[model samples]
Target chain A: MDFSSKLLEQAVLEMSQLPGIGKRTALRLVLHLLKQPEMQTLQLTDALSNLRTQIKLCKNCHNISDTDLCEICANPTRVKEIVCVVEDIRDVMAIENTGQYRGLYHVLGGKISPMDGIGPSQLKIKSLIDKVREGEIEEIIFALSSTLEGDTTNFYIFKQLEGLEIKTSTIARGISVGDELEYADEVTLGRSIANRVPFESSLKS
Target chain B: MDFSSKLLEQAVLEMSQLPGIGKRTALRLVLHLLKQPEMQTLQLTDALSNLRTQIKLCKNCHNISDTDLCEICANPTRVKEIVCVVEDIRDVMAIENTGQYRGLYHVLGGKISPMDGIGPSQLKIKSLIDKVREGEIEEIIFALSSTLEGDTTNFYIFKQLEGLEIKTSTIARGISVGDELEYADEVTLGRSIANRVPFESSLKS
Candidate 1:
């Protein structure tokens, strides 16, 4: 990590600040940039700077967006009355990629992790409550990961909407479609049995 | 991978172009940047843009530098008469970390690889030859990797300097110090034996 040039050292330090990147990987990446045409670096810098400066959260869903309303929330064809609550935009992207869910999304930005000082108040919980109380939303789907913090956040939000007459549901947790039954974890295998769906419903595409 | 925002998609695309990064990792990094203050992104962009736009290479050794001469080439204590030729700045850094070699370095930029459309002429071979012909250099250490391309580049330079009186040697190829004998590859084990040094020389720290 002892870069001979101060500029190189600064660049490597900034690069390594990324979540999983280390000093060695940062050096490798910076050196790779040095080898490529300056246009590549310029493009990357421009993209990053522009993203930081110009990006906005979707006013309705709290998803990262260039406009006040995100594309999904703005689309009239999407089921606006049915909202999918997700931890972040990646979850939104993952769910969108499946093309099965046509509902709008509400990004919580993160889960309720007291260890990390993240809690319900820091999230978009109040905004979500406002949306639910507006009376148009019929169903709210909880799509957070099945982690401890995820469950805590889900329950916190569910309790807030308790007095309201809206239906709330969570994403089904079970063995992956192609995974062998024997390889499935005990908790998931047991849940799949206890919450077994109608045989005909499983036959749907 | 269908990002709702064009800015996000472009940023992710540029980020993923880095070696060993992928679309998912890129998204994670971009989202992490979004979660942080704008200052972090600005700092990163400024560093990268500055590095790309203002960085220079050493005129003598072709290493990335802020000035015409890199630190090693400008140092009076490092032996200018003994040069360790390497593939790139990373190799130079690796050797420098050892603190054993007290000589200047000539960065080839890359090894000769016909498959990659890189040849001797594309490298800094001519400048290296010019340095040798200046007649002050007494030893030229071939410190390139032991890959086929590395060997090809080393041999190409060796043939060029065949008539010169300077000493030439490759870094030793052997099983690593702590590697188990049973796990050592036959080629490396054999080469280590063939190129064995004096037992007393090995004992030197």
Candidate 2:
């Protein structure tokens, strides 16, 4: 770890500060950058700095955006009345990739995890509640993970919307498309059986 | 892979360009950075850009440095006559970490790899030969890796120094200190047997 230059050491230290990168990996990455043209390093640095300083969050849904409104929230074709709620931007991207749903999104930023000190106040729950209270949203879909924290967040929000004139539902749980029936968890298998669709309706997809 | 914003996409693309980082990992890293304070990203970007643009190579040893001469070559206590020739700065650091060698170093930048179109001219070999021709170097130790490329580079340099007055040697190859003999590779085990050292010399360390 004895670097030849202070600049190299500083670079490695900063790089290793990233979540999963260690000092050795940081050193390797920095050395790789050193081997490339200066333009590559400049480009990388510029992108990172620009992202940190100039990136904006959507006012409506709390998703990262280049403007006040995100693409999904701004799109006229997307259903404004049907909002799918999820944790973080990755889920939004995942749902967007499916091309199956045309609804808007409300990113919670994170679920309610008391172990991690995150609660409703730390998320975008208030803004979502405000949007629903404005009486425009007709249905709210809970598309969060099936973890304990996810359920806790969903229940917390559901309690807040007790008298609101909106329908709320969770995404369906079942065995994955290619999974064997025997391998499916008991809870999922039971739910899949209870929520079984009519034989003709299953042919729509 | 449809990004919500152009800036996010650009940052992820640049990050994924790094070795061992894929698009998914790049997205994760970028998102982690986004969640942190802007100052952290600015510091990292500054360090990277500075390291790439301002770093220098030592004139004497061709190792990375902040000045004209590297620390090892600049030190008056290090033996100037005895030089350990290595493939790159990493080897120099590795040998320095051992705390056994007190000699100067000559970094070749890279080995002579014909398959990769790398030749002596592409490396610091000519400067090494020039140093030997200067008649100041008394001994040159080859500390390159145990690969075919390493051997080809060593042999090529050895041929050039055939008529020189300097003594030439290579680092000893044997079983690693903590490794079991039964698990040792055949080539290394055979060489260890063929070049067995005196029992008293083995006990010196």
Candidate 3:
């Protein structure tokens, strides 16, 4: 679209570079900023700039952090022996919100997606293997999504830990809580039935 | 939802302030930016900052511009005597894209909406009246959306120019082009019938 001002055009172009935002949406967003107080724009730009320049990753788990270590990795209450392997920090946040598990996390940054040119080396798989080799973690939980890429990454790491003396398991897949049984997908329903847990164990949770 | 890093939280908060963006979408956008090269974030922030700090408004029509006088106003070919009054710069761009209008534009910045605490004084209405009083413009066209606010704003300006010798007209409102007549709304279809032009006039366009 033709823009009267080069500044507006540049801003829209940069905004549209973001995932899911198209040129029309970018224009609307930039125009919204233009209409708001100048302080709003200043605050937004400052926050983004600070995040890019000053944000740090946890030295232990590679999760986004303000310091050298993330809060979860640094907390003494969190279980260091049982590490949960996941795709990224968003998944970590999701599990943390559930408040069901206390295990520390090892953020893989992303799954092994060959279609997207993301191999095992592009992820944090090496660091995880190194941590396991050091004998720090006992139980490893594969909490990644149940997609093909997720399974590939999980299997790759599982193969690497073949000789290690650590227990490995994947998160249970089933119909979501509060969802109707009929609405569950075929693969998930089949898995849920095949890997059925004991009735008493379900009551315990 | 809880964020792992304060910088991430701040960036998400500022991003969510944009219209139609919620916390979830903000987090997704921020995470996408984090995964991209740091230079992407820098460029986005820089462009937004530059636009906010350096963008100027046209001295003639109050449209966003990089110069005192906008390209449309500066152009000798555009008709200075016929001015299309619109809500904002987006409308100006939309009208310009038609390639039919060779007239100058007068951006009102926004319509007078009492519900939003917006008054005529907050808009560029006074300057438009002053221009009409100066006898430079011969015809004033109201090309604003057919909303209550748009109509109110148009009437308010029409009253202000009541005694002026300039001709006042509103853009024709009807069913959109290529829209099925059966699906057209009652008001628009009625307006189209009530304000029907000659068949030869329609054929000419």
Candidate 4:
């Protein structure tokens, strides 16, 4: 599209560089910012700049943080010996929202996706393994998604801790709590049946 | 959702302020930026800041521009005596892309919508009238949308120029060029039939 101003075109071009935003949507967003108070634009840019410049990664688990260690890692109440392994901070937030698990998280940053050129070295797998080898963590729960890359990353880490004294486990795969049995996919349904737990154990949770 | 970092929360909060963007989508976009190189975030913020700080509005048409007068208004080849009235710069760009209109544009900024607290006095309608009164314009084309607010704005401007000698016309409302007749809405179909042009006039265009 022909923009009357170079500044507008530049802004839209940069805005469209985002993952899901297109040029037209970027134009609409930029025009919206133009129509709003100047303070809105300033605040947005300032916040983004501050995030990129000043944000930190938790030294312990690689999760995003405002300080050297994330809130979960700094909290003494969280169980540091039982580390939940997952991909990125979104997963960490999802698990935290559940209020079920009190263990600390080890953010892998990403899965072992060879197609995207992301391998074991690109993630925080080494740090997690080092923590386990140092005898700081007693249990490692694989909380990654059920995708092939997730399984591959989990198996790779499990193999790294082969001779270690730490106990390893994975989050259970099952039909959703409220979903009907008929709608469940075959793989998940089969897994749920194969890994059936005692009725009293389910009630305890 | 609980964000691990204050900077991340602030960035997501500011990003979500844009139209149509929700908190989850904002978090995703912000996290995507975090994963990318820091330079990407810097460039995006710089572009937005530059656009907001340095952008200019065309004095003649009120369209977004990099100069005092817009390109269309500055171009000597464009017809100076005919002006197409639009609601905003988006309309100006849309018409310019068609490559059919050679006349200049007058961007009204917005329509007269009482529900939105917008009125004639808030738009650029006065400047358009002033230009017409100075005998600088021979024709005024209403290219606003076909909504009630658009028609009200058009009729209000039409009344203001009741005693003027200049010709006044509106863009033809019809089924879109490639649209099927069966899918056409009742109001547009009726208007298209009532305002059907002569066969020779249609062929001339």
lDDT of every predicted structure (CA atoms)? 0.92, 0.93, 0.94, 0.94
**Every candidate's TM-score, chain A alone:** 0.98, 0.96, 0.98, 0.98
Alpha carbon lDDT at A23, candidate 3: 96
Better of 1 and 2 by lDDT: 2
Q: For each candidate, what is chain B's TM-score?
A: 0.96, 0.97, 0.98, 0.96
Ordered list by DockQ, greatest first: 2, 4, 3, 1
| Candidate fnat values, all | 0.84, 0.97, 0.93, 0.93
**C-alpha lDDT of residue B89 in model 4:** 87
lDDT of 4 by residue, B49-68 (tens): 99998898899989999999
How would you encode candidate 3's per-residue C-alpha lDDT over A30-58 as one tens digit per residue?
A: 99998888999999999998998899989
Off by over 4 Å in 4: none
Proportion of the native interface contacts kept in model 2: 0.97
Q: Which pairs in model 1 have colliding backbones?
A: none
Each candidate structure's count of clashing pairs: 0, 0, 0, 0
C-alpha lDDT of residue A86 in model 1: 97
State TM-scores per candidate.
0.96, 0.97, 0.97, 0.97
Which clashing pairs does model 4 show? none
TM-score of 3: 0.97
What is the per-residue lDDT of model 3 for residues B1-205, given as tens digits with 9 covering 90 to 100?
8998999999999999999899999999998988889999999999999999899999999999999999999999889999999999889999999998999999999999999999999999999999998999999999999999999999999999987899988999998889999999999999999999999999976
In model 4, the Cα lDDT at residue B88 comes to: 93
Q: What 10-residue stretch in candidate 1 chain B is worst by lDDT?
A: B162-171
Candidate that beats the other on DockQ, 3 or 4, i.e. the better one: 4
